[model samples]
Target chain A: DAGITQSPRHKVTETGTPVTLRCHQTENHRYMYWYRQDPGHGLRLIHYSYGVKDTDKGEVSDGYSVSRSKTEDFLLTLESATSSQTSVYFCAIRATNTDTQYFGPGTRLTVL
Target chain B: QKEVEQDPGPLSVPEGAIVSLNCTYSNSAFQYFMWYRQYSRKGPELLMYTYSSGNKEDGRFTAQVDKSSKYISLFIRDSQPSDSATYLCAMTDNAGGTSYGKLTFGQGTILTVHP
Candidate 1:
């Protein structure tokens, strides 16, 4: 509902292959986040972008990289996919004025 | 221990029952609190937000925060089947720098309201 959409709603890739997931927002939010959800582990932050060309690592940033060249788009890439990386990825936009975050539909990724 | 801890209950109750979900945190610096409801295969959606302490009510949902106890609770009155979903508690410290917009989340509690 935040005008956020994730590309490749679902993906399947073999281990050791590089994969990139995309998050697009229409509201022009300044802060965006990527999180991975796994059974029993809950949601863990992967990476986030506060502005164009600005990014930061999160709790579980290893094996993953992010780029925000534009305000509306943020990309998360797995240098080499692994079985441990299989999970549902969610994108969120933080409302600077409201101090709230809204989430996208999410992308389900599987690494064989 | 994890920063935030939740019961992670796969709780099931009859429709119209009052449902209580809770979370506890170890970090006292967390000032902003929020609740998110997520359905199967869907992303989480914000349900309620309360800053610091005290109670805030929104329709049939009530959120209570006790900063001193480092505990937060969500109460749903007259719960409906539509409310059956995983509830996640999230908090953040606006201390700026690395703590800017990062949120720490609970393990989430699964609820099922049966008709």
Candidate 2:
């Protein structure tokens, strides 16, 4: 909601292929996060970055990796797409601690 | 047990009715609480945020947090059809600022307000 944009709003890929989703923010927020949403399940964190080049894995980070090379950009990569990874991906950013997170529209990824 | 528990109700209400959504967490250390609303096929949008115990009201929405009981609630004073969506509760410890992204979320509850 806060000047965040996610690229490739929808994607269909084959298993074993790699896919990258990009999150770009115009607000220069210091914190960025990647999460996946599935039916009946809450948004599960994949990875997050606190500052440029500082990243940490989340509860569901097995096959995913994240990079934050700049203040305005965060990238999430699925090293190898799988059917189980098919879901809606979201990017969120926060400018201060304990503050509300602003989210990008989202990217729907489907791997067959 | 899951750290956060929500009913995930497909709760239906008539227009202008008051609606309540709730979540209970197991982590006693969690001090920050929040509620988010997500429309169908859309990303979750924050509706309410509160820290510690007590309540905070904004416009027609009120958020309540009870750290002693490890529970949180969101009340909509006059629910309308526009309010229909999936409501999610998120919590963290010292979950403020531009760092420390460890907030945990509960399965959202689906609410429908009929006219």
Candidate 3:
């Protein structure tokens, strides 16, 4: 397992509140991604960063945002949380491609 | 249609049984197909990947991809209790994997290998 850790392994927040999940990697990989896992849907990419300050929207980016200020840290923030946004989020990092992707444990966020 | 489709099967099998998991995609541009195993409440771990079309075997796991049919499969021989996890099918195209491997994932099939 790659040394990847997600902070606030679990969190509960009120609707319309702001929440941020953090992913820190020791591998210093070039690519980092944020994805939300729902019951009926697989992991849906919210945003990803190819390098510091270089990011792009994913299919499910409408309600989410991301930032990668430093190579080791990637953050996913819900500007204003909604009940529909309750889901488990995962972070993945790869050296270059998809040959091997190490995942952080996960962050379970619930918007009440 | 979604790029990838997999039956979210709660497929149950007895210990030592052979288990088959699969996913199908519509994109012919997909060149890399991968299978990930995810335990509950955890992130997905890569299991197998087959570039283009063919079969690759490792340990008790076999991965098969038929690009002509846009179908990919993972077969586990002699399933074990530790193998009880959600199997997700993911694919990356030259279109998606360029900058970083942007993969499209299936809903994931839950499997339980019992004793």
Candidate 4:
């Protein structure tokens, strides 16, 4: 509930197609994170950004990429979608003062 | 073994009952512990966070951490239907370096409070 929003709450794309998910935040937090949720795996971090033009790979960074050009927006892109990439993606923002991370509504993507 | 382990339960309980959820971790370096509540088709929301160990209470919720046992728990008193959701446990080491602020999470436990 930290003024975070993820676009295209739901999407379905065929395999080998490019897909992009957008996360926008109004809180102006310095840190933003992208995570994918799947059964038995809980939530796995995909990528994160600490500031403008600053980014880092997470535990499950394969087959995906991220960019942060502005403090309010972080983008996650899949160069080519795969069946294994079908899952719920969540965006989170961590305030500079606190260690807690607030999340966006999330996006559900499917690959055929 | 995974760094954090939790029972993925669809525990069902009646309203007003006390609910307990737990998570165990293999890493002793984790210093920051957190609990998040996630509803179906929605992202997770932070419920509680504690640093180091001991007990922290907030209204109907209480979070306990035992660093020695590498275990943590979240208790809900007088649970309500609105409290039905998947509870995820997460931890991190804030001691700096590249791992700072990076969280490792448990598989999560689903609880349903029926009215």
Fnat values, candidates in order: 0.46, 0.73, 0.62, 0.62
Considering only chain B, report the TM-score of each candidate against the true chain B.
0.95, 0.95, 0.94, 0.95
What DockQ do you compute for every candidate structure? 0.57, 0.70, 0.61, 0.61
Error of 4 at B1 (Å): 0.5
Question: Each model's TM-score, in the order given?
Answer: 0.97, 0.96, 0.96, 0.96
The best candidate in terms of lDDT = 1
| Tens-digit lDDT string for candidate 1 (B35-99) | 99999999999999988999999999999999999999999999999999999999998733433
Off by over 4 Å in 1: B95-99
Q: Give every collision pair in model 1.
A: none
CA-based DockQ, model 3: 0.61
- lDDT digits (tens) for residues A3-25 of candidate 4: 99999899999999999999999
Candidate 3 C-alpha lDDT tens digits along B1-115: 8889999989999999999898989988888788999987778988887788999999999999999998999999999999999999888775335566778899999999999
Candidate 1, residues A23-99: lDDT per residue as tens digits?
99999888999999998888999999889999999999999999999999999999999999999999999986655
> Which lDDT tens digits does candidate 2 get at residues B1-115?
8899999999999999999899999999888788999998777888888889999999999999988888899999889999999999998876564447577899989999999
Error of 3 at B94 (Å): 2.5
Question: In model 3 chain B, where is the ten-residue run with the lowest total lDDT?
Answer: B92-101
Question: Would you give the TM-score of chain B in model 3?
Answer: 0.94
Worst 10 residues of 2 chain A by lDDT: A94-103
Backbone-clash count (model 4): 0
Taking the tens digit of each residue's C-alpha lDDT, what string does model 3 give over A11-111?
A: 99999999999999998888898989998888888898889999999889988989999999999999999999999989998756454566899999999
Model 3: what TM-score?
Answer: 0.96
As a TM-score, model 2 comes out at: 0.96
Error of 1 at B69 (Å): 0.6
The weakest ten consecutive residues by lDDT in model 1 chain B span B93-102
